[model samples]
Target chain A: MSYKAITLKKRPETVISEDLFDVVELNQPDLLDGQVLVKLSHLSLDPAMRGWMSPDENSYIPPVKLGDVMRASGVGDIVESKNEQFPVGTRVMGLMGLTEYAVSDGSNLNIVPKEIPQEAILSVVALPGVTAYHGLFEVLKPQKGQTIAITAAAGSVGSLVGQMAKNLGLTVIGVAGTNEKCQWLTEELGFDHALNYKADDFQNQLTNASSNGIDLFFENTGGTAQAPIFNAMNAHGRIAVCGLIAEYNKTEASAGPSWVGIIKKRLNIQGFTMPDHFHKFPEYGKALGQMLMKGELKYRAHTLEGINSATSGINLLFSGENKGKLIVKL
Target chain B: MSYKAITLKKRPETVISEDLFDVVELNQPDLLDGQVLVKLSHLSLDPAMRGWMSPDENSYIPPVKLGDVMRASGVGDIVESKNEQFPVGTRVMGLMGLTEYAVSDGSNLNIVPKEIPQEAILSVVALPGVTAYHGLFEVLKPQKGQTIAITAAAGSVGSLVGQMAKNLGLTVIGVAGTNEKCQWLTEELGFDHALNYKADDFQNQLTNASSNGIDLFFENTGGTAQAPIFNAMNAHGRIAVCGLIAEYNKTEASAGPSWVGIIKKRLNIQGFTMPDHFHKFPEYGKALGQMLMKGELKYRAHTLEGINSATSGINLLFSGENKGKLIVKL
Candidate 1:
């Protein structure tokens, strides 16, 4: 049998283009002993994928080598399995590549229940959701009545962070690229305020919205947009650095302020990747799933049909073209 | 009776000069109800004093207003007291300005035992010691066998941080401005390694000294010196942002490298001030005091005599002229 896969053609210096990947046909090999053949149905597109594409950057995960399958989190079904634990027809999620089929020994795979929707499994119950959970609870540790300002407020992680913070009684202020995204954050996600970072009055809006000052900053995007928010942080503020999508595509390094605020405000800035906290994902996923089932947690996914579209679909994240969780359906 | 005091004549934009202060003699006033008359014997000179002199910078304490006594931590003898808790001739320490006499309402004062040397009270038992304590114990949380790097490692806070970290069984690497300071750190303070940041091969030295990568960075001096250290941090590294003495004297803000390391290494950068953690002082002081008396912990105080020399003494801190805990003996 033949399966479709996308391989990294060349590492880009700055902004990623569709040309960086090549869509190719590969022969599907028979499952070896204790191995399961997973027919992937969905692939997760994330901002961190940009970091993984860099040849020189050191990250939590190893960089994708040239001519190798692009690294991604994906959900699929075990079509054929020699492993008793993961029998045929069992649904699983893991660090499967951007491919139509995968061969797994079940090392990193997690069993996903049939009841959970594929979109949620690819989003709120997967990488983005678990990232939001760990970064918020473990890193930021928001308190009741504290104000939290989240950047990339409409993205997969930021959107869930705003909702969860609101649910936990934190006043949520969001910063996003567009007015539409900002509107969705405040109007739909129950955020106290949302400022379009692209707007001329962004600084004023941010200042006014966070009059009480931000107690916690969920930093998803790092660039010039962070300066005003950093200036508005109260004493002893916590900043959970989940991703820096704003600087991901830039050739030159972004300029930050004097950082005197870090001392004056006594802020705690912690950067984290979800994989490091995978041990807690099961508990996080169970809680997040329960919330979703009871309608207490809400999430959105922007899916691009077909695995072939992943090249263009992934760029949507860098260009801010897609709202919510960007995913590819194979 | 009259005593000399240094008042902020004007705020300096960068490097502090003697001209910013005016030495004036003021008549000692009668104590009001609940007030204690403190005759300051030793005044603490700190890098954070430069920040307090900045008119526009945000700080834990309000800036020392123009014409007001310059904000400083001092050890003194309460010659007169209306408060029953603090008897006459009782030694005390607090934000008793750079002066020969101060009348306080006893709001921020801490009673110091006569057995504790005035130099220890001004250096190890006071702000600098407390800052090193909280920053290491609470923020960095260093573990045995971890490699700890400290900037300005011969100065007040950094010196103590090195000794404490060494006592705790961590490999301590010290970064200082001069060879003499570096020698003192490794030879006297028991740091595993010491590098002169001003040396031509500083970067190579830092790389070789910290080949295992720094686990905890007790950041005292900030600016360009941080770039190499930031790059050499291990995964899950912690940085305690105690002070930016390097930038304190710079007219233009120093350019820092892309903070990609903060994310790439999952570094936790926490900035703090001692005043904010005053509640932890008693416990910290008791432990530190015990260590000092038993000779388990070593510290040095470079005292400049006479209250009038405070103008020059403070400048020594920016010039890196003072080797250890810079203090003014009034």
Candidate 2:
């Protein structure tokens, strides 16, 4: 029997395009003594994938090797198993990659509850949830009643961050690219204020939205919104740099504001990635699951059908076209 | 009796020109009960003075008020005392302003050892030493084997920082604006490598100096040296933005490098000023004194004679003409 998988063909020069990947068919290997076979149901498309496609040894996580199945996390279930802990029909989630089937020796897979839909798992209990939880609660160390400004607030991780902050009694200001996304952030996600970064008066809007100045900043899209939000930070402000989706595609990323503000405000800026804290996944997943059940985390998946669409569909994230979490149904 | 002092007459629009200050002779006031009179001997000139001359509410410390004696820290002797704790002939140091004499209520002055020279006290146990200690130990938290790079490497604080890092078993690279400063850093200060930031191949020199990539960066001068040093940082790097002297005098500060490298390296950047950490001064001062007495820290005092010269002589710090610690011998 054979299944399809996407393999990284070349490194991206500037932007992600079709020539960077190749769709291939692979034969299913016989399961070893302790192996469990998982047929993936959903694949997550994230901005981090752009980094994984580039060959930078200095990056937080090592890039996916050329001629190998592209690296990714997804939801799947055990169709056949030799491991007693992971029986047949047991649903699992892990870095199962951009493939239909995976043979895991129980080291890479975690058993997940089946009642929760695949979209919910990938959206709330997977990479986006963990990234948001760590960056907000750990990196930013936000205090209740503090004003927080989040860029890319309409996207997967940003939306969760805003919701979590809002629930914790913080004054949330969300910056997005489109007014419709801004409206959705306020109307659907319950963000206090959402401003379109594309507006000519974006800085004015930011200043007005944060009358007391921002105390915490959750940076996801390091774009036009970075300077204004950074400038509006109060004394002793903290910033968590989680992602720079806006600058990843650019050959020459623009300059950030001068460090004089960093000294004047005595700000603390830290860049973090989830790979460093993978040990806390189960713990974070449990907490995130509780929040999801109580309806505290409202998630929407702008999903694509089939694994073949994964290659081109991931570009929506860089273009800021995806309305919500971008997922693939395998 | 009258004593001369420099008063802040106007805020500098850009550079710290002599017109911004007015030299005036102030009549000595009769000491009330519990008052002590200090005959100022030596005043410390630092890059931080530029910020104090401007009127910015958002600054870490309040700016000097218009029509008021300019703020500065100095070592002095208690010539007359009504306070029992500070008897006549006792030595002290505090923010006594750029003056010939100061009347203190025993609240601002800290008693100093009579054994140490006033120049050594100001250079090693005062603002410069404490700033260097706090930024290095508390902020950078450097490891013994780490490679650290410091800008303004021949200045009061930077010189101390490099020596301390070198003493602690870390490889130290010092950067400055002149060949003389760089030579002093390598030959006299025992810095492993010293590069002139103004050289045409500065970036190339930095790359050669830090072949393993820089783990710790102590930024004092945020001039052209910032980008090259920032670009040469290693993964999980830490940067302490202690000062930006180059940008302080500019009408408009230039932009910093993009934050994309911050994420790619998972870097930690923190900005700090000594005003926020004044409570630890006594502790830092004691530790610094021990290092000074043991001959582990070497400092040179570049003294300008008389109170009147202080008004114009302070510019030596901004122009990088001062060989070491800039001091006023009043």
Q: Write the per-residue lDDT of candidate 1 for residues A1-330, one digit (tens) a residue.
A: 998999999998888889999999999897889999999998999888888888654578889999999999999999999999999999999999999999999997999998988998887889888998899999999899999999998999999999999999999999999889988887788999988888888899888998898899999888767888888989899998888888877777686556567888888888888778878989998988887788877778998999988998888998899988998988
Per-residue alpha-carbon lDDT of candidate 1 for residues B1-330, written as tens digits (9 for 90 to 100):
999999999889766788999999999998888999998989998887888888653578778889999989999998999999889999989988889999999887988889979998777888888888899999999899999999988988888899999989999999998899889888888889999888889999998998788899998888657888888899999998889887877776665556667788888888988878778888988888887788877778898999988998888888889978888887
Query: How many Å off is the CA of A198 in candidate 2?
Result: 1.3
Q: Which stretches of candidate 1 lie over 4 Å from their true place?
A: B32-35, B55-57
Choose the strongest candidate by DockQ. Answer: 2
B156-268 in candidate 2: lDDT tens per residue?
A: 99999999999999999999989998998988989999999889998889899899999999999998999988998998999999999999999889899899999999899
Note the Cα lDDT for every prediction shown: 0.87, 0.93
* Superposed model 2: Cα runs more than 4 Å off: none
TM value for model 2: 0.98
lDDT tens readout by residue for model 2, A194-272? 9999999998899899999999999999888999899999999999999998899999998999999999999999999
